[model samples]
Target: MRTRPAGDEEGAGSSTPPAPPVSLLRSGRALLEHIGPYRWRIVLGGLLGLAGAAAAVGQPLAARALIQDLGRHDAVAGALTLLSGLVLLGAVLKALSQYVLAHAAESVVLNARSRLTTRLIRLKVRELERTEPGDLLSRVTSDTTLLRQVTTQSVVSAVTGVLTLIGVVVMMATLDPVLLWTTLAVVVLVGAVISGVLPRISRATAHAQAAVGAMGALLERTLGAIRTVKASGAEERETARVRRAAEDAWHRGVQAAKWQAVMGTAAGLSVQLSFLSVLGVGGARVASGAIEVSTLVAFLLFLFYLMEPVSQLIQAATQFHIGAAAVARLREVELLETDDAPPRPTRTRRRSPAGRPATVVFDKVVFRYRPELPDVHRGVDFEAPGGMTALVGPSGTGKSTVFALLERFYEPTSGRVLVDGRDILTLPLPELRASIGYIEQDAPALSGTLRDNLLLAAPEATEEDVHDVLVRTRLDAFVHALPAGLDTPVGHRGTRLSGGERQRVAIARALLRKPRLLLLDEATSQLDATNELALRDVVVEVARETTVLVIAHRLSTVAMADRIVVMDSGRVRATGTHEELLARDALYRKLAATQLLLPTPEGFTKAEASQG
Candidate 1:
């Protein structure tokens, strides 16, 4: 089983797969829930839309009257002038209404994307274990864009189309009841075709969007390690991998387009059939003298008007189906569990004496990343009684796992981790993590100003506290040399700074928090002899005030530890002061000789030794 850097789910002997996706209608409704806060605006837009449809309906009725008035010789010219003026006014009002609805549609998109962005940032770390950065980014960007199209264009058009359809039907009935029956028959057929085709559109769109996300994930993985690929002469291989994903996305998109084409064809067919049936029946009525020529002409015009709204309604439904598919992708990320919220402070939290440190105990801990995999920590037991304690072990001996468990990033399969006589699990996550300062082997930094990186853990830290930590960590000179000083921008992952500088920056950031227990994992691995010595002094000095736990990679870093715990094969072999352990433990002596020294012309020299 592959394990993540922190929280990792076990690959069990048996595990049930997740349930199938929710229905498109249910997913569409869930997307609409984001529009609740802007309902008033949407309602206003809808009213304007209805007014536009009302104007559209009135146009044909006026044209029918104009034709009949032209046949009459009485005040014919005057009636034509009035009719022209009314048509112009209706056109202006319709344009204004459409503008208002367009604005409301944009606002809905903004609100939804904002909420989705917030959720993405707060998601729990474990979710990252199962997710890809590129796929998550695609959902945030392109999927949200599709949702915008649905909310603004599709939903608004649907509302206006329905209103126009109703108005056209009313006019048709007034003109002739027999002709209206023919139109309703075509409407029923159109509705049935739409219902069948909409599900197909939805399924195709879902597959297409998923393929796009896969393409994004592949591209992201490649570009993130571009240098490695080039160094290993694997660029051509990686290019082919991304090309395959892109081609897959294209194929899926073509499938969706085919489904949409069928829906569009159905909509057009309904309009043509309705027009033919209306013309056939209306011609018979006029021939039998049941309605006048002018009335039959008006009924035929209304039938043509029905086509516009019906076509729009069908087009809007197609857009909605596509949007619903994208909504499902967005919901997958938005529905993920978020990190633990801040806990209320309680009196039960342990507070030790001045100049002393918090006690840490690992009690019979047994943990494996996966249930089907071998245990990383097997019935482990150890204790650190404050002061400075160094944990020495060979690589893969679970030194880093101890730090992860202490931070509560993942719970042990069984056993308890106690801090100052209190179960760490009983403490709220934020509170437990806040009490301990952890510096990983990489000492990761974000893209930001030096001041921004330093103040991340303690945003409220004052300028004096910042200067104090900088001086203690030996970063003061480096910052002072810069033109912008603390305000200087640190390039991505602090690439602008040397490895030692980056390590010191991470240490300074943690120090500003004033944690009771400090866990340093290979904190000085990147530093040169001079910088390493300076950082060692800083660690020893800090240990006087708080408990310090060091996962020692170099023996020189922990030579003065108050006590040293030597571990092998996931269990502690011995614990004592550094010198005492060196004498009593064979593993300790071997590790010290390898990590602390090298043979020189004079003898074994600690400074000139290659690091173990």
Candidate 2:
């Protein structure tokens, strides 16, 4: 089996992986890629905003002319008209820009959700085993929502804000160079303080998002097993656990909010301080006859106007930091591996054409779930040829692992598994899986109508074929009794159905596929004796035309197998008919006798027999 190096074994108890380094440049690039398709819309919005800023910029100049005309007792009608027009024009342009940006932002979110959802569904099974489903769901919903604001509005706002700030600075310089220098000094000092605060906002937001994901995962876990929790009387404990996660999220969110508030305060303070410094200096200059009254008024107006761009810049920065944290999470999901399998074929059929059943062979196969874990299968070797072959072993002896390997839910660490004289690894995944029908140990049913679950594997199966399989699995009567028949809804995980009913549904679904190889992992474990016997006859009938491999513990099921493979500690201990193995294999005999499949020997006590 595969093994991990000794150096990598340290700190195996850590509950979470180390956080990745946060890179603003990398995050920005990823955001740009997501925004690529909507670039033109964002550009149009930015242009409109620039136009609005231009109109606002001209208003102060018009007001200065109007004031000069009034002082000289000249006609001010023309100047007043110009000022009014600029105000209305600026308002209209800004409104149009905001609408366009909002639309583009929503589109960005939709595209992101679509791409992330596709990646999530196609992720390798091994990755899903290690990741929490609830956390993945949060990434798809909450995380992608962050991209809507940051991708378009924030990007365009930053560009327009910077250009507007520069234009306003130039206008202020024209009024008085000394006043402009005073304003610049104050802005520079506050800008430095805000720079230190942005990184903290990013870090805090990252922590808050992670806490939210953890909370979601915890909530999903509790709700998924609410019945079990209620049975165990652990409602209080689970509630406390989820509440702690929520509190952690709240604390981290508060930290992010604290830093954002600091940045906003600094941006506002810089503009206010610049205003005070310019007003005092310009009033003294006017007193010294260094500048006109109209000049001073216009300069003050420009200083006030500086606040708009300053606020925009700060808002853009804050949104970028928050969105970057989300981008990082989304990127981590994109980096996960996916199965390299062909797309599933669209055709459907009731059964494979009549032919010799497919044979299976496990040639010294070795396997494990992970590198750090011990091998679950140690050189397991077995063969099943065109008939019903049952695998019997004590619990945890790698019985279920064999079925998982056959389905390629996992890959063997070593050795080869062959189907019909060809290595399974050489076959396309879709083709390999399409040829086999498997019933899991739990026989899970999805949340949907009974018809939906029955048609999941064979969506195009005809009604006649469905009715035939349902009768064979002894589910026709039960399904008919339901108020809606096949249209009846099964609650989440088939909670609406009894355990026996779910198992029979699973069996019927598999039978509808008409697979060349059928794998039953405790297929009838939940069935009543009468139903079990009936399904056993169905399996015997199906095995005549196709291969059937089963992992069973009940003695009646094993006694009917054409061949039996007895396993012990991941190795095949014996393989033969049930009677031959019972006479030779100690483990098989013990298992058989435990179920009272054999008569009691002369010296065996009742207690020993019960404990066997």
Candidate 3:
């Protein structure tokens, strides 16, 4: 086992500094870009909303005609019919516009989520390792939801509200300039208060969103290791930690709600104050005979109707502030580094052939997980020439780091890693990875059917290929015992299977890929004696077809390797056959003695040594 250095698990307790706050202008531009695809639909919705406003405006004029008709004792049926038509038309247009905008909103959210997920999958390993999985998950799910309203409905609402407000003001001015001026005074005062409140809403919403992400991270952390928590009797402790996170989220959410409530109240107050001032001044003007009773009634009707545009404008601004926070969080994810290399063209199953065993070389390699951490590989030099090579060492000897470097999961600090005599950095990532299969220590299995886990690496593999690999890994009997055989659900992380079964399944999956190089880290650790012996034989057989690089502590497995490399303190100390190393290397001799693979001084015999 390789010792994990400090900062290796930084994401668990600490994270990179929070990204700088995104500018309002940049966030606004991002929102607009999200809306770009649905611009035509949004335009149609806005046009319909404007038409609805036009109909609403005509209702007041119709009411004024009706009032004049009533005062003159003239027939009023035509005036009543016109007012009813305007009301019905306005309602129908508003409904149609709302439906169009709602549909567009859902589409926008889908696209945003798809793009974010795509970017996340391609992000560099370093970025992923240093970020909480749950936090990234929240951005894909919750953050993208905010784009729905801001991208379509809020944008159209803002535009229609401004246009309608202008139209209402002009008509009000025509009715009575004195009353219009009086109404403007109240609106202007309220508008200034609302402007101040909007920024605070943005800031509050950003904090609230961050707290929600933290809560999600805590929940994910607890659930991911529920078995360990239960076994250790720490259920209550973990629950309390998650509960505290949830409480923090709740507090931040309330803060945002308070600011939003203030904005809402200010918007309503602006309309109410304008109505009172207009009524008082319009009444005085009517008394002076400057305007007719009908004109005063129509102007008052417009003042009441003015609330629609005012509320729309305020609502648009509020939604934008809320969405800007989500945009900033989303932008932070976008800024994380991603693999820039284009994937190599995939070969068709029929056209592709089996890969030749690859030669691997680590030339003066040096590596550290982070610049602040101590070096894991200190100018280590080694070579494996297409055969079974076993790396045996004490803990913290940089054994696992070699596989990581080979997979290009992390770059070497100041040296070269070559596969088939070519620098790995110069190869396309997909192409390089496709030729290598790595079975990690834990041997994790995804949540799916047995067949799904088996074909994960080789999706193009045939049913015959699956069965052949299963037999090689001695898993055919286990699959036959399963209720659904290959179709059985594996459960989360293959909890349904035993530890040894998961390891064999992982090996079978990797073998199906027909990789040129197979790297195994403690592949036999979970197995019983019977299964371990079986797997050892399978590995030896596979080594004849491809390069097999294994890290093992068990002398039983190491003894079978064609060559054994003794490693210590991040450097290769010796390379030779097991018998040759036992005769020459001090570390190899002690290690074999510990496993009882070699005879001890006090009790040793040829028969006992041969059996061992």
Instruction: Indicate which candidate wins on TM-score.
Output: 3
Q: Write the per-residue lDDT of candidate 1 for residues 204-282, one digit (tens) a residue.
A: 8888777777778778877777768899998988888778778878888899999888988888888889888988888
Cα-based lDDT at residue 355, candidate 1: 34
Candidate 3 lDDT tens digits, 390-491: 998877889998998888878899899999999999988878888888898889999999999999888989988898898989999889998999999999
User: For residues 39-70, what per-residue lDDT tens digits would candidate 2 score against the true structure?
Assistant: 99999999999999999999999999999999
Which scores better on lDDT, 2 or 3?
2
In model 1, the worst 10-residue window by lDDT is: 10-19
Give the range where candidate 2 is weakest over 10 consecutive residues by summed lDDT: 1-10
Candidates 2 and 3, the one with greater TM-score = 3
Q: Which one wins by lDDT: 1 or 2?
A: 2
Alpha-carbon lDDT, every model: 0.78, 0.86, 0.85
In what order do the candidates fall by TM-score, top score first?
3, 2, 1
lDDT order, best first, reads 2, 3, 1
Off by over 4 Å in 2: 1-19, 341-356, 595-612
Each model's Cα RMSD: 5.3, 3.8, 3.6
lDDT of 1: 0.78
Better of 1 and 3 by lDDT: 3
